[model samples]
Target: MDTTQLKHLLGEMTRAEKIGQMVQLAGEFYKEEDSENTGPMHEMNMTPKKMTVSGSVLGISGAETLINIQKEHLAKSRLGIPLLFMADVVHGYRTIFPVPLAMASTWQPELVEESANVSATEAAVSGLHVTFAPMVDLVRDARWGRVMESTGEDPYLNQLYARAFVRGYQGQDLKNDPFSVAACVKHFAGYGAPVAGREYNTVELSERTLKEMYLPAYQAGISEGSKLVMTAFNSLEGVPATANKPLMRETLRKELGFEGVLISDWASVGELIPHGIAKDLKQAGELAIQAGVDIEMMTGGYLNYLNELIDEGKVSEELLNEAVWRILTLKNELGLFENPYRGANSELENNLVFSKEHREKARIVAEESIVLLKNEKQVLPLTHHQKVALIVPEDQSKDVLGPWSWKGEPSESVSVYEGLLNHISKEAIVVKTIDHSKNDRPKDWLDDVSTADVIVAALGESSYMSGEGASRSNIKLPAEQIQVIKELRTLNKPIVLILFNGRPLDLTDVVQDVDSILEAWFPGTEAGTAIGNILYGTKNPSGKLTMSFPRAVGQVPLYYNQDNTGRPLTAYNQEDKYLSRYLDVDNRPLFPFGYGLSYTQFSYSPMKVTLSKSEREQTDKIIVETTITNSGKVTGSEVVQLYIRDKVGQVVRPIKELKRFKKILLEPGEVATILFELNQQDLEYVHQDLSVSVESGEFDLMIGSNSEEVETTTVYLELKKNE
Candidate 1:
């Protein structure tokens, strides 16, 4: 269908039908014979008439279910416009891959894209038209449960992953591609940085901070062709993001060049009433439509009062037509008019749901995502000959499929015990599975631990402990698991801690108890096998931390790129009591961002920077290079990270910012020279008055494996006058 046909279809739609096209309801609304007074429908004041004509449905999949729903919706429609089916196909569909946080740890956007492609393929076959994924929210707080959904804290990394996900989900063409589904980049404006790390909490960020730190991720995704944008639940600068005109209209539409549909998260449009901005649902609907929210998700505000607002002169008919036009345009792009059931195929779904090939890809990604956090005395790479003592909780089936793996099966997942069984003979290994649900500790396993050479303890938060609606004020290991570690610590054998979590944990208490620690943030369905391979050295651990692990919960929002305070804590001022130093704890994080250890070691030589032209020209390029050598005895990959700090700026600058990085594989004792090019414009930041410009000053360039541990060198950057 072309523009003329789409416009004709819209012209034929009634006022109610046009408003219905801007509403997306749950699948339950379409299932019941009379859904008007059922459950939350009556509470939201949704009538049965609106339910029959809703433009989109969410949270229902499977080819048969969606085919039936779409057929029913089209049958009821006067214009025969098919309803869109969308879901939160975040990480994976059936063959669950590692969570997005773990995927980001791999430092490989291509692999991340592959995982998204597999997810889109699986969901598309299940009859989903759009996926609200590649969240792209820059998060610094581990306590924010949705951190699992985001890539990491860095804007550059998040921007790269955002683009990769968009490419994978949308592919070359959404209409022509059978495997691809339209991507919806979500939580439009700063939903990740909720105050107190609580879900749906208020976000108070300046326009400058929002542009500099958060908006780039969403900008990158939209620029890469994401079809839709979801409004956040939080309020930005005292204005609800669902109805913030400056952000949704000016920044997103005019400045960022996003011509796609804008939808609300859950019932955010209706939430404006409770947010104190609107007095009633009628005003809320008007504000949302006027503010440029194209769709109201899971809310009846648009259906109930949007047309009324248009008649009362609160909203323009042009605005309503524009919103409906975007929706109709998307429907045309999805080829819904030609074939409503685009990718629905039962046979294809059965064959591709959890194919062996997809599982292999998940295993490969999980292997790269498992970060080795600590390996004191080189206790890892446990030989098969050594008798193993595995102490894990009994209810470990769901641990593999962490939160947001809504379609993942716990029974189909391999447990750590099941994976380790293949490597060690049954009689050679002693397994002590304690039922954590009960209060009792298994003292009977002490004898097995006394005889074993090494103890591999699998412990961390449960699947529900760290994803949407699961924020934790105390982001520490569960007390029961910590007690288990303490009991194992009484013995002389070295303990290998394999963590299965969704967010960065406070590991200060147990860091010393375990000899080796692997930060495996929910390695999806093949979690057990991936851990087994990395433990036995079949696959090397190369993943780095995307978010900083705080020493304590007090440092909840900690990151390496923190602002330099007036009273900075330094080596020379260690004894200065008035300085910005903690009285009880060190200011450093337990594990800094980009910090991870490999089975093999790589060392970086002093970095050298060369200027291309006069420094004043912001477009001039500067080349930075360093020699990296694999010093360890095994072949491995290293993520050589480059960071820069503005020595002086108009506004206070961060200690350092991650400019660029390279993931290189090297043979034992082999050396390679790595080069990174930086443009003078890259060093610019948002000034106090909101202008962005690079100041002529000295800058420090650093290169290292991680953020905290790096070798620094000085370089002078000049800003030339206009040509």
Candidate 2:
């Protein structure tokens, strides 16, 4: 019956019709000429730009323009197979939500899911049919440029975010939906663990690490019903992930039971020539298709060479038919095949630039994603009555939104100053720092910083500095921005540093010097207001930092859950004796995992586990309860983290692994109970042979503000081997 609907529809398609399903050329790439435009991807493809791509990727998103382009492709193509429009609607579409990294910091699946839901509703209404999102890559090293785009360091959290994103994007029904664009969980296998955190770099990992840590998120995405997957540009075991049949076919499709399509990352199929695996474009096409890459994204790998590769017996016709069927089935599911341009609802388009509700929601997400990283001497939750000098040290126009905020507009975007102005009375002086783009810049925003009661200095990477291709070796603030902060400190006024960046930065100098610091990681269009709300007490800042900030770039790639070595430094004062310690600096990082500061202080009592191992043989339920109290004058939210330490193991394990975390908001002088009900499923980990099972052990339950600082309790559990 399923085949009947798709095959009968396919029977009517001509050669061009079928070919269109396989092609995915960049739709809105910049072109030199209008009449004969090939787009940016053509140069990478080594072909003329005028090629008729089957699917057009609107990497450049403008609702009206995207509709026009898709229409043109449908009209121009010989068989008239309507083009599927795709884009990197990564976080927020138009109304920017927090960056994916910042969202992960919340450790709240509900927020992440709702944010994705809003993204899908907005993007679909804006005329997009598919999104390359939820980029479910598990990143450990913060120095890697793309770290800002992933859920940090843990497979469990990444899985939670993946499932949330998939449900938000596709919803419960895929066979009939116009507003929800089909979710495409991307960079299929091990894209996050690039060597030295470089982009599109080689991945090297043991089979156990790969199975236990790296592969779970992809499995989660598949289980959540993600319809499409994109393979990574990097190679695993020296074979490109895009061309690794074992990973694509064996691990993903067959083992994980994913029946969806596997698309290639941008221009990656043709890149096999440089990878030295394929002789030419034709060979590249043969290898990728045979390896299970169903669609050639912007590379023409399947477009010009697939048929010939099939004729030569390098790729089976069965592969082509399977690929085509997967695509056509999705199209049918989207209701696109029956009504070619089903998503092109003019009413939705007409009313979809942005609305009051969208802006309001953006504000909420922005506020929710702002992580209070450090605040010494209890210096935050600024009052409206206080005369604050909001210094736009970096270009306010540029830094307020932080990089990769595609939806944010300068005037329309909420400015930190605007937020301040709205919260305060007429008496409050909201001074604007001069826009000085001089050849010789000043030390700070202005000389007289001492006069103000408080100061707000905005700093970090400009918008567009830390997403896909934005890799940075030295993760430090620009010299100019650093200078601004240093100069403001001369006045001895309590200063608050607002950092806007995609990835974590090494701010050892600023952290020690500034009174307070806010990590507002790319807070979208409503950034100013969200930040402003937190500063003037409209909203209590509840976000926790997802990635760890390093003291120096030398301590790069630092994360929690790293394996303890045999030579872990035990000597009180010794030189490098092959201990897991750095010689130049301390092995410890400036900040640790699960670290964040609040305006108010939080006290945690020792943890209590209600359920025991004796009753575990039945329905296993571990009810963990911890009391979190606000012991400060101001109100703030705290994220209580629970970590588990395997006291003894057949194999080596990390010092501490995050079991669960709860984000709770508390008023001043208030106490709340935090609880997590974990099942036996939660206790499972890959054995030496690489299958998940819970083994009996004496486990240490460590509760902490961050990974390094912990108050722990011990618990004994009994389970048979292969448990």
Please name the candidate that would achieve the greatest lDDT relative to the true structure: 1
Cα lDDT of candidate 2 equals 0.76
What does the lDDT come to for candidate 1?
0.89
Q: State the C-alpha lDDT per candidate.
A: 0.89, 0.76
What's the TM-score of each model vs. the native? 0.97, 0.92
List ranges where model 2 is wrong by over 4 Å.
12-16, 29-53, 60-80, 425-446, 570-578, 613-619, 633-635
Off by over 4 Å in 1: 32-35, 45-48, 440-442, 614-619, 721-723
Tens digits of lDDT, candidate 2, 31-113: 43523324455444433333454654546555666667666666666555566777888877776777888888777888788
Error of 1 at 142 (Å): 1.4
